[model samples]
Each structure stands twice: as structure tokens, then as C-alpha cells.
Target: MQKYSERKNSAIDKTANPESGNVQPKPRRRRTAVNRGLDENGNGKRKPRRQARRSRSGGFKNTFLLTGIEILGLSVAAVCAVIMLLGYSAGRFSGTSFFGHLLPFTAGVLVLIVAAALFLLGWWKLRQWLRRYSEFLTPALSLSLALLTPWLVTHDQFTLAYGNFRTLVGGKEEAGRMTISHQVYAAYRRHDAAQLQKMVNRAQEYRQAIEDAARSFAVDAHLLHGIAATESSFIPRDSHDGGRGLFQITRVPETVIAQARKRLNVEKISLDDPRHNAFVAAATFKHYLAEMKDDLFLGLLAYNIGPANGGLRFIMQQYGATDFTTIQPYLQTLPRDYPIRVLAYSLAFRLWQQEGRLLAYEEGNNAIRIQRIGIPGLRAGL
Candidate 1:
């Protein structure tokens, strides 16, 4: 009994010793260049990596900055697009202006910049978030890309409208709308005895019928020159658009052609000859002018657009009041400025007589603003 109790007490003493489960393990020392070796598992290896690079406090600040810049640029792009569209609506369709043409180009560039910046920002935010949160990045990137489509489409429409506006503004300039011929007007302006003799000689040879027609119509000889210049450019032998001959008369209906054949004693009236066409046109206008002496402008306008559709009356009502100064603003879209152009021809004739040359542009000589210029006693404001 005494041996058994002594053994049990010795076992309890061994179990209660301080070194049983609390033994002091060796401290781990960092590797040095001279003694670095493989890890104990099998082969040497690197330590496990730490958390992601943007794991700390500063990461959110950068994201907010990127988002703000992106939104600001996008807002600027949208505003520029609106302004350009307004210019187009106001009849400033010609993109020849620096601001006009660049409107659309600017919009496109802005959109691209905004999209790229926003995409980069979203991507960066997503990458950071994905390290800790997978669900948010997928839908966020999808929505951003989808939203970019409308911006790109609007940019294209703005560009197209700008281009159309340029063409609508008459080749983009005044010069294009009414190009001038310099050489012919120059030949007309000689004012010397010898020069007169030379003009006489040329007139007799190249232009006898013109003088005869002018005499009969009581029209200024220079008016004939203006007509010829505008009608055929003095080429005499070309025709277009129901226009037959130098004066571009569309009055070659079957009855008129038959009468022309009988009167001129030609089997058929050919549009290629200047003399026949010029005489006929002068005769027609002379008759019309005599009948409508009260309103020369209306008569001329009637002859050009014709009395067919009240187009002339509509024009008169639309453009008559303020004179011709602001008439261009009312035109929707016409291939030519009909009134201004015919007046240009009239001025050409006046200048042809006064200066004896074809000037590029001549002041309208009270012709364009006929009612405005006046004699002192007869017309202070009449």
C-alpha cells in the first residue's frame, strides 16, 4: 500500500511541472546574406504577400478627384454641342468660320476625352474594389460603357449638321454666290478717241445686232451689255434649262418657235445663235416693261420667277418692306440670290458705261435701294 501511494504522488508531481506545456521555444531570427537557406517544409520560398497596394486611407481621395474631372469635362462637351446646334438653326450653317466648323470637332474631341477619363477612373476604382468586392465592378463597368453610346452618336449628328450648314450658306461665302468676270467689263471702259475707234470697229463686227435691238427697245446700250454678260457670258452659242440662245429665253414653245421660224425666215430657231435669242428676249422685255412701267422691280421679278404660283407676290410680301438690306435672312434655301444677282448685273452695266471695265463688285448706284435714294425737293423721304 505504501509503494502504490508513493508512485501516484510522483506522477502527479511530473504533470504539475512548469515545463510541461509552457516550454520556452527558440526565437526566429531574420536571414542574413551569408547564411540564408531553404525553408524547412522542403525548398526555400518567399514570405506570403501583404494586402493590396491601395488598402489604406488615401485611396478614396484619388477616386473622387478622377470622377470630378471626368464629369466637368463631359458637362463642358454637352454645352458646346448645344451652342453649335443653335448657330446652325440661325442660318449660320457654313462651317467656314473658325468657331462654326470647330463646334462639332470640339464636341467630338471633348466626348472622347471624357469617355476615356471616365473609363479609366471607373476601371481603377473597380480594380481596387475587386480586390475586396467582386460584385460591384462588373455592373459598374457595363453601365459606363453603355452610357457612352449616346454621347458618341450625338457627336456625329452635330458634325453632319455643321457640314450641311456650310453648303447651305452658298459655298460658304459672298464671293462664291456671285462670282465676277473681270475681262469683259474692262474692255467696255475705254474712254479715248483711239479707244472709241477700236470699240467702234469691234462693235460693228461682234455686236451690231445688240446696238440695233437697244435702239428699238429704248434700252441703254450698256444694259444690253449687262444682259449679254449675265445671259451667255458673251459666248452666244450655249443653251440650258429651256433657255434658247444668248439671252436664255425659255419662250421657245411650239407656237413661239413656229412664229420665230416664220419671222426670222429660219426653218428652226436654234438656241446656239446669239443674235436671234437676244433680239427675241429684248423684244419680250420691252413689251413687258411698257405695260408695267409703274413697277419696274415687280415686272422684272415677275419675268424671272414668273406669275405662275404667286411666288413673286410671296417674295414681295416677304422681302419688300425693309428694302433688300435684310432680305437674305428670309431665304430658306435657294440655289442663287435672284434679286441681288440681277441687280448685280444692272450695276455691271452702269459700271461698264462709267468705268468701261468689268469690276468685281460695284456699289448698287441707288438701283438696289431705288426708293431710298432721292432728289432733295421731290423726295426727302419719299
Candidate 2:
């Protein structure tokens, strides 16, 4: 019995001593509050509140940003569409009388508004369907449509429409401009092609000098060419009218001469030199153009009249003339048709530059095409 008890005690000591060769099972671990997702009170813990809030805020911001971009893009497209439609309608319904003009314009506006609304609704539906393909697809299409409007207005077929619309809204100033433009057309029609061709050929000799002066003074090269053509017919000589050189420059302002001298970097000016003559002429024209508030007709007239008898500005003030039209009656003693002749010649040079030859103003479709090309130093596209 003593041997049995001693053997049992030895076994117990070996099990408790891990260094002994006997294997022992590990103790089972009790669950902690953190692993079980409970607080010290045994309640379920909430997810990190700040992280959840941040995720919701981020989603809301993305939604707002996309909404703003979509609205801006659609507004741009709508404005472009409205301008095109209004311009087209105005051109089609233009008239002088109340019934002839007002009724048709009003009817057209109503019709166009209804049509535009229907079109927008259809487009919105289409956008909804396209959104399934790509979130950007609708916005891209809208922006593309907006960009295309400018090109469309400038297109040959649409230019006339746009011009007519401008005229309709442009009032008396536009009427005067149109009148002067037609006068130019008429003058051009009267030109003998062979003689005009000779003038164009002669212009080639001074073309480089004239172009350089024009560039220096920010004047149109063709316009300078026109002045030369009218003044000396490209002969570059003194005239009986006390005018000298290719431009027939006379009575230029002291400031104009100084500006020309500065541009040429010359201490003295000689009218005999074509380059000097061209530069002086360009500077003089630019000076007059500024004085006349950039009215192409009045500017040309002022240049032609020069500072003689207190210049074109003084003459206008004396006669209470506000525009080229009002000044016409007072210009009988002056070269009233000077600007027209200059522009007619300028148009010829422009034609030569564009078409490689002068177009007959009466030829088939040439009239419309030439008008579209427009006069140099003025707006093009009719």
C-alpha cells in the first residue's frame, strides 16, 4: 500500500512540472468583452460614429457636385439654342409694317417655344436612357451641341440669316451702314475690268511696303492699298492738289507725322520714298479712325478731308452732324464719295487676295459670295 501511494504522488508531480516529459492540455481561455463586441456592461458596442458620418457626407458631396455640373452644361446648351432659333426666325419674318412684321414674328416665337420644349423633353428622356451606359454621356453630348452653334452661324447658308437678324435689331445705324455698303457695290459694278486689273498689277510693286506699314500701324493692308490706288493709281507722284506720294498725303497732323516717324525710326520724312509715304499714310489713317470713334465711313472721310478748314471733326461740329448720314448734307464741298471709292478699291484687292482674281460684281452668284467675303477693315460674313 505504501509503494502504490508513493507511485501515485510521483505521477501527479510530473504532470504539474512542465519540464518533465509528460504532455499537458492547455487551459481553455475565457471570452473577453472586446472579442465578443460588448462593453464592460455586457452591452453591444456601436460602430465608430465619426467614420459612418464621414462616409454619408462624402456621398452627399459627390451627388451635389455632379448635379451642379449637369445644370451648368444644360444652361449653356439652352442659351445657344435660343440664339440660333431667334436669329433664324427674325430673318425669316423681317418686315416694315406692324401686321407684316409683328404678327409673323410673334407667331414664330410661339411655335419655336413649343417646339423647343418638346425637343427638350425628348432629349431628357434620351439622357435618362443613356445614363445607364455612362454618367458622362449626356453632358458630353450637350457640350458638343453648344460648341457646334458658332460653326453653324458662320456657315454659308446661315450667314445671310444671321446678318438679316442683326440688321433687324441694328436700327438706324445699320440702315446707314447698309446704304453705304450698297453704294460701294454700285461703284464696284461701274469699274472697267481691264483698267481695274491694270491697277491691281501696278499695286504689286508697292505691296510689300504698304503691307509693312499697315502691320506697323494696325491698319488693314488692303485699305492702305485702296488709298494708294485712289491717290496716285500706284504711280507714286506729286499731284496738282498739293498732295504727294503713293497715298497723296496732305495736311497730316503733327502727332500723326511724329507717330509715323517713330514707327519708321527715321529722323526725317521724305514723301518721295514709297515706304515712307506708306507709313505716313497708315499712321494718318489710324489717327483719323480713332478720332471718328471707329466708324469705318466717318474714319475714311476724316482721313480724306484731313485737317484742312479745321478737319472733318470741326466740320461735323459746325453742322451738328452726329453720323456719316447727318454729315452727308454738309459734305457737298468736300469729297463726299471718297470713302465709297476707297472701299470699292479695297474690296477689289480683297477679292484678288481671296479668289486670285477680281470677281465681277454682276456675275452669277458672285454678288452673294463677294458680300459674304465682306469688305476688309470691316466685319466679314455679310
Candidate 3:
């Protein structure tokens, strides 16, 4: 009994001594309401609440700063894109300029790069928008906007409408002067890029003669040059319609030819000679211009379709019209496109003579040979 009691006391001692290495761990102290801003009543405590409010305020400030920075970046990009696009569309830096070639070339290339970057960014944004929206709505809205873009830009802002995909890539310039040649416009309508190319290329060969004739008649050399281009593309030929030579003299009375010869002080004149042809064409144009009371459109029309289609006077009298626009509707019945064609060619030649190229964008492209001043020895004969 004594031994049994001693053993039990030893076991008790061992249990109480944690150094024996067989002790149970103490209970963990649970965090109370005050530690996490909660009170005994379960309401949020003031100290922790203030700290949380401060944290939220800091987060909001950071977010606002980030948003502002994003907006600023986007605004700068937009401004740059617009400037570049404007420069590109207005042809401010292609071919040649009054400001200087190097300036335009450098500026054009830089603007093109910026415009390209902006276009790429916009394309990416468009893709993102498409992804963010429903499939049906995205395509439908995008298509509608795309279709409307050209129409709105062309009609409202003429100069800024020089995008590659626009209806009028070159813009509606020289509208009033477009009626100077019929054959040129016909070629344009037919999309005869080859013949059109020839017109400019051959201009250099007969340029001197055209200039002299125009000077004699007190006419814009480019205008007369345009007429020759339209009539024959500077190639001497006879048409089945009875048109002949560089000017394609068709129905001029013998008396008028004799009078022209006398006025030019040339005893023997042949339509085959470019110089003579240019003189005759200029004289004819002058006579018709006076006959139609100096109405350029009417004069040009009479030269193209002949005065016999009731003449410009009879047509104007019949329609009670005074201006081209007023008479335009009736003109469709005749060779109205003739004048427009002449004008287009004339305008192109004028641009070439002034800027050393056909268009502001014609440089570096294979569209037309802008630098073809004629064959090296071709000018010798003239």
C-alpha cells in the first residue's frame, strides 16, 4: 500500500513538470473585439475605422492620378494623329512645294510615320471595342460608320478629304476648268490610264510649240497644251470622225483656215505641223469664246460638239439657261463630258508645270511617270 501510493505520487509529479517533455500546449489567446475595431456590442471601433478610411482615401488618390495620366496620354496621341492626317490629306508634302522640296519630303515622311502609328493604334482600339461588345452590334455599327465617313468628309471638308479610300482622292479642285477638253474626260471615264500617261509624257516634246501658240492667242499655255493632249495625246493622226492632226481639226470651213493662215502670217500651213495645229486650235477656241459672249463653258462645248447642235446660243435660248450649272442637265444630251475631260487634263498639266509633278501624291509611286520630260532627242524635231 505504501509503494502503490508512492508510485501514484511520482506519476502526478511527472505530469505537473513540463520539463519532462510530455506536456500539453496552453490554449491560444483569441483576438477580442477591440483588436479588429469591433466593440463588445459588435459595433465598429473608432480607431480602426479611421485607419481604414485613410487607406481607402490613399487608394482613391492613386486611382485618380493614374486615370488622369491615361487621359493626358490619349489626348496627346489624338492631337498628333490629327496633325499628321491633315498634312497627308492636303498633300502638303508630296512631289514639290513652294516652301521647298526637302522640307516637304522630310515632313511628309515623318507625318506618314506618325499617321501610321495612329492608324495602327486606332485599329487595335477598334478590335478591342469589337471584343468588348456583342458580335452583332459591333459589326453593324462599324460598317455604318465606315460607310458614312467618306461621304461626310468629302462633302463637308474638301481639302482634308485626301485619304486613299475616299471617293475623290485628289479633292474637287479645278471644277470650273474641267470643261476645257472632251477627249481627255472621255479617256478619264474610260479609265485609260495608259493614254492618260502618254498625254503628260508627250507634253514635253511639243511644249515649246504649245507655249508659242498660246502666247500668240493670249491663252494659258497649259490650257492649250491640255487641248493637244486630249485631241491626239501629241500624236499626229486622223480619226474616222474626220478629226486630224495634233488639234484634230474636224469641220473648220476652208474660209476659216485661210483666215487663220492670213492672221498667223503663214502662206502655207498644214494641220500636220504641231505648231500650225496649235495655232489653229487656239484661234478656233478664241473665235468660239467670242461667239458665245466669252462664256468659257459654252465656247468649250461648241468646240467639242460643234456649234451645229443648235450651238451654245440656241441651246441656252432653248433651255433659258445662263450658266453651266443651269445648262448642265441639257448638256448630257450632247458631248458635255468633253469639256470636263479637257479641264482635267489641263489641270494635271498645270500642276505638272508648276510643281514638277502631276499630283501632290504622285511622287515615288508607279501610277504615272511624273518626271518624263519627253524622250531625250524627241524635242529636237520641234
Best by TM-score: 2
The TM-score measured for candidate 3 stands at 0.45
Across 206-302, the per-residue lDDT of candidate 3 in tens digits comes to 8888788778777667668767777887888989988889989887646557756876799987888888887888888777777777766667777
1 or 2: which has the higher TM-score? Answer: 2
Provide the lDDT at 234 for model 3.
Answer: 82
TM-score of 2: 0.78
Evaluation by TM-score, superior candidate among 1 and 3: 3
Off by over 4 Å in 3: 1-195, 253-259, 360-382
Worst 10 residues of 3 by lDDT: 373-382
Q: lDDT for each of the candidates? A: 0.48, 0.85, 0.62
Please give, for residues 298-323, the per-residue lDDT of candidate 1 as tens digits: 33444455434454446657666332
- Estimate candidate 1's alpha-carbon lDDT, on a 0 to 1 scale: 0.48
lDDT of 2 by residue, 1-382 (tens): 9999999999888888988989567677888896677888879875788989999999898767765666677787676566666777787777767788879889888988898889889988998998899877776776676677667655765666656666777877676677778888899889999999999999999999999999999989989988888888999878888999899987888898899899999999998899999999999999999999998889999988888889999999999999888899988788889988999999999999999999998988888788888887767554
Clashes of each: 10, 0, 8
Q: Which prediction has the highest lDDT against the true structure? A: 2
Model 3, CA-based lDDT? 0.62
What's the ranking of the predictions by lDDT, best on top? Answer: 2, 3, 1
Model 3 residue-pair collision total: 8
